[model samples]
Target: MRLGPDTLGTLPAEIAQCGYDRAGQAIGVVHFGIGAFHRAHQAWYLDRAMAAGERDWAISALTLRSPTVAEQLGPQDGLYSLTERAGAGERTRVIGAVREVLFARPDAERAIERVAAPECRIVSFTVTEKGYCRAESGGLDLERAQESFYPVLSAALAQRAARGQAGVTLLSCDNLAGNGAVLHGLVREWLAAHSPDTLAWFEANCTSPSTMVDRIVPRTTEADLQALEERLGLEDRGAVFTERFSQWVIEDDFAARRPRWEELGVQMVADVAPYEAAKLRMLNGAHSLLAYCGLRAGHTYVHEAAGDPALRQLAERLMVDEAMPTLDPAPGQDLAAYARDLLTRFADPALRHRLDQIAMDGTQKIPQRWLDTAAWHCARGQAPGAIREAFDAWCWHLADARFVDDPEAKRLVRAASGGGRQTLLDACFGGGAGAPLWPEYAHLRPLFEGRRGGS
Candidate 1:
């Protein structure tokens, strides 16, 4: 059993010694939401940068939701495992890129200090789409009190305003359209309430650079833990495993020093809008569809769902026909290659991506996943059959039903369904379900008022 850092590996104290050689403190980026994905992806990229002797980019990992991660990681000298799983088996690698870790559980006061740290030049986030505390109009919503919700950027800018420190770039690596603008609005709202002067500093000196991060980080199960324990002969309480594929794209705009992240496979571009839209509409949207409909179709896990001949073809066709044509071309992205790679990653049996895990928060997720594209197609006089199928599946799944794994979403689902498809469509879309949309979407109303997952 791994009792401490001695059993896991050497403590990461060396990385924080300001050992950037020439760059002094090196890159001081504060990354929020310390989850398994950020550990395997962003932290790995920083490790690669450090190994290549590209000093100056060290990360301060911050957790806003859970305190367990902070407790476990802080003592082990900020130690964790990044096990890479592929077709063959699992390979274990220790990640030590995080020089420090902080918690924002109870409040944002201290968390804001870390983000506003003078040495902390770039503040990045893996806080996901819902964390920005934004409303439908893409402005800050003060009453964001959900589990995943937090006023992170808002508080950070307030700290900057009070300290007279400005000009720190805000980077959002979540999956959202124009994530920068989303974050910018959240920060601006906090500024308007707390410090309007600071908002000016942010606008003049800082920039919210939009970014898109893609990877398949499945839940690390007990089976994965057992496999890693045997392979390394070391027990890690926080060991996380993932399929072997990753990607990151950033719209290059920064106020202070940042890592040459492009040095290690990260693509820097003029704008990430097209790419973000493509991934959001196709990749993430499809993931949601498969998580619900695929499971109802009798598939157990994400791998099982992808391996299904019918479901696999459904995914490919949805991407090729319904999803791809809706978005413009990315600079260096090969749509065909990207789609193929996503399938391979999703199909990895060992990863065992949980169906319910993706299914949770459907109330918050479906707007972006299935509804947005469906509404767009409706306006263009086109029918979004595949997406509607997904919407219907989601509405059905929300009935405290066993479509995936969300009790909370299941409770809220009745608000959409229970009555009829038109009623559900009315609830999900409101006045803007599009003009021609309700008619095409009404085709599925009968199903919603009926039982779900009969097949």
Candidate 2:
């Protein structure tokens, strides 16, 4: 039987201790982009907060682009099983923080209404890097505003302002650097285009708290569902599989009411920039490198890539030599330990984090992950060798017909096909040509070019 309120009582006794019985929690948060990561990370944290006696923080999850998640989870009354895997062991938790789910296409007004509600004091979301509709210069990409969440949020905030609703906190759980500020800037630009008064109201009211979220949530597959079903003795199409590790470091700034999330394992820090930089550069940067290099070396998943000696070495070199040097770690934080932990997590054979999945939207991800770190190294007369290799792998991946999905695929592949690696690097630097990739790695440029052509 499908898991729902009706079936809650019938869930195995083993699952009883998992999530608290959220029988009458109010929907205090309206989150956009209902995906596996959101469910696994944010909702999971909220579930713990509720379990610890917070009542008014249940989430009204909304999907902006598709109804697929809502369709799968709605039937179960927004309840789903999170199966955390580590090697041969599995731990299942029935997350209940999602009190309601909505599809934004046909229910945009409803979504706006929900966010405008008095109880909805927090509007949080996890729409990935590309979802921000960011421009090349790191501000809001004004041209892509219509297709972004910014416009939708602007409309919702306008309604709230019109209704004289109190300000709500807008928390961003995406991996972007200064994600909260980024979202805030985007919303401001969006409102500027549509309603300047609403922009004024928002500036006086809402707060976008930056957050650093860490977790490995691979896209759920049928095998995961089958494994869940066998374990629970019930068909749970809404089940999501994730690694046993998770971390959420949020800036301690909110406009209105919020859960006492700090008591529930969430690090409420004053300055999240240090944490954000370290994770972005070391963890996400290495992940992208692994994605490109691993795929080129015939590996399918993160563990497979991490287990490969050559790829593993490359990842370590990138993390310690290239990425870590760029980061100014928090006081007393062990950078080496952090890098080792990431490699250990990456090598977890239970999680099947696909390279193609991480490699998506390379054009959007490159600026923050690679280019920033590369620029840092270049300014010091140091060669970003590991990053160059990863960039080469990305170019090679784009050139391959099998690998398709990057927004800049056509241009990148064209460059890689004819002009080799230099053309691709030149494009990344916006026609700066060989300057960024110069001096330190100038002698090594031909190596990458020769490898790409020879292959």
Candidate 3:
């Protein structure tokens, strides 16, 4: 049987399911960018929260640029399965946190109206790093911002303000450091330029809490879907699979009604920067290193490369020697333990996390992942060899890889031309007059250029 409200009785008895009636919940949250990660992590949490009796936080998921998720889940009444795997064991649960789904392309106005609704107390999104439409200087890309989600969001805020509706919290679930604050600035910048009135109202009312979200949600494949069908004896078009590990550290700031997320395992803290910095550098940075360098060495998935002795050494060196020195975690937080967990997580063979997926948007990711740490090390008179090697791998990935999916791919490819290490670095760094560099940059070039076995 196909999964939907009508097929609820047909759901497998062994499958963990939501106990709450979907009709009992109101749409208190609207999540933009209904991708697999959002479904597996955020929606999964909300589903558990509602099932555990936090009934006021049902979600209405929206996809801005694509109708793919809506097309798949709408027929099922926004119900989908989240299969969490660890080693050979897996748990499947039907999620009903997303009570409604919207495709922004055809129903843009309705989406805006939903955001403006008084019932929608929280508006969160998982638009990837590039979806923010940030410029080279890390601010709002003015031209792109005009054509991006910011305008629609700004209009929604305008509608709310005009209707005298209460302001809502805007949470960003993307992997970017200081994601909420960054999103707040982008919205403020866009509104300051486009609608001053909305800007004034938003400044006085809304809150954007910075968040650090972690989960390994690989893109679903046909094989995964087929296996899920076999195991469950039902057709679930919106099924998503992810690793057993999941985390959400949010700065305790909210303008409206906050979901009882503490009951559902979300870490609400006084400060999120320390955690955010740690994850971005230690976990995400190492992932980038593995992606570019690993793929160049003929590995397809993260586990394949992370399991390799040479690649594992490189990752360890990058995290411990290069990345960790730049981070200062909270008093009780264990940075060393976190580093150990990152490697273990990456090496999970069950989760086929693709290097190419992690490698996308290299330009946007580099500033936070490697460049910032490299700059920090340089200011302290450190060499930062591992970071430089990663950059070299990134350049090579651009020049030689079968596919490059960066917005700046054309420019990066041009800059990656064969002259030497400096030429490639200069091109990748955009030929800036005062570009950041490590003391041992020159020495690091040959290692990457030679495609040496290890870091």
Per-prediction TM-score, please? 0.86, 0.93, 0.93
Error of 2 at 426 (Å): 4.1
**Candidate 2 per-residue lDDT over residues 1-455, each given as its tens digit:** 88887777776777743356665778898998989999888998888888888888889888877889889988888889998889988888898888888887787778878888888899998877778876655567778767656666778888889988889999999888899888888888778888888988899999988999999999899988887777777777778889988888999889987888888788888889988998888899999999988888988999999999988999999889988878887887788999999999999989988988988887767667877788787777787888878877887787774765876677667776776665765655434443332233343343344444212
Order of quality (lDDT): 3, 2, 1
What local lDDT score does residue 409 receive in model 3, on the 0 to 100 scale? 77
The sequence of per-residue lDDT tens digits that candidate 1 reaches over residues 91-192 is: 566766776677776545666667767777877788866676665565666666334424555567657767777568888887778888887777767677
Superposed by TM-score, candidate 3 places the C-alpha of residue 340 at a distance from the truth, in angstroms, of: 0.9
> Relative to the unseen true structure, what is the C-alpha lDDT of residue 259 in candidate 1, on a scale of 0 to 100?
77
Error of 2 at 259 (Å): 1.2
Clashes of each: 6, 0, 0
Q: Output candidate 1 Cα RMSD.
A: 4.7
- The better candidate by lDDT, 1 or 2, is 2
Model 3 sits at a Cα RMSD from the real structure of 3.3
Please tell me which model should have the higher lDDT, number 1 or number 3: 3
